[model samples]
Target: MKIIKDDLAGTEIKALLQEHLDDMYATSPPESVHALDVDALRRPEITFWSAWLESDLVGCIALKSLEPGHGEIKSMRTANIARGKGVAKTLLQHLVEQARSSGLHKLSLETGTQAFFAPARNLYLGYGFKECAPFSDYRLDPNSVFMTKCIKE
Candidate 1:
């Protein structure tokens, strides 16, 4: 599979993002949903990427620069059919490498504390991300779990 930077304008990618948003809303309360829409992902601070297997879009992920040496993981999703195929894992590894190469000293993310997000929290934990206080514009919320990993300089 090939992962490339995306413009967030393609029909397939748009549809996939919409699906991701839907899932987020379905799983979390409106106030707790932090997943950005397409327009937000297109901002200069965010670098979006899609994983493609030939012509099919397999998954997508984004890295958002939070500061000079910090980044956040956003919009990580694998197509329904692509789940269990390591698409998310591969994309995450790719993002980590990209962040390190870009001179980022750390990477962080916010995910739900609900059962629906358990798998995601586990995935982050497996990658050495530790629970942390909210960073950036985030405020403390019982439904939210913040995680961060320090990258070797």
Candidate 2:
């Protein structure tokens, strides 16, 4: 798979992001949904990347610079056709590597607390992210689960 920095321009990626938002809303209440849409992902502080398996858009992920040496994960999604193909894992690894190389000392994310998000929680946990209290502008919300990792390398 090839992972490339993105600009939220391709129809395939836009469709993937829309599907991601749709699932977030379906799994969590409106107030609990923190997933960003295409426009939000295009913010200057967010560095987005999309993965391709040959000609197929397989997955995407982003790292939003929250402050010096800190970043928050955003828009992590694998296309339906790419599930179970290690696409999410690859995208995550790429993002983490980039963050570390770019001098980010920490990485964090907020995900749903429902059963629908079990796989994602497990993925983050396996990658050394530990559950933490809300960070940044996030406040206490039972519907949200926050995980963080120290990546100073």
Candidate 3:
């Protein structure tokens, strides 16, 4: 599988993002859902990528610049059929490498604190992310958990 920067205009990607949003809403309260939609991910500050296995889209992730050397992870999701296949691992590694190359010193993300988000939380923890207080414009929320990692440049 290969990771490619995406334009967020393809039907497949849109569907995937919608599925991601739906799952987020299903798992967390509306006030706690931070997953961005297609239009939000298309903004200039966000760089979105899609993981493809041949012609199939397996997973996706985005990096949104928060400051000169900091970024926030957004819209991470793997296709249902692609779970347990290391699709998210590969995509995350790609984003980490891309962040390092782009001079980003930190990467942070917010996810649900519910049981439905256990796998995702574990994935980030396994990737070296540590739990942290809310960053940027985020405030404390019972339904949300924040994680961050500092990249070595």
Candidate 1 versus the native: TM-score?
Answer: 0.98
Ranking by lDDT: 1, 2, 3
Query: Which residue runs does candidate 1 get wrong by more than 4 Å?
Result: none
lDDT of 2 at 68: 94
* Residue lDDT tens for model 2, 105-148: 99999999999899999999999999999999998899999999
Over 4 Å off in model 2, which ranges?
A: none
lDDT of each: 0.96, 0.94, 0.93
Give stretches of model 3 more than 4 Å off. none
lDDT of 1 at 62: 100
How does residue 97 of candidate 1 score in lDDT?
A: 92
Clashing pairs in 3: none
Worst 10 residues of 3 by lDDT: 24-33
Q: List the residue pairs that clash in candidate 1.
A: none
Candidate 3 lDDT tens digits, 39-149:
888899999999999999999999999979999999999999899999999989999999999999999999888898899999999999999999999999999999999
TM-score of each: 0.98, 0.98, 0.98
* Model 1: how far residue 68 lies from native, Å: 1.2
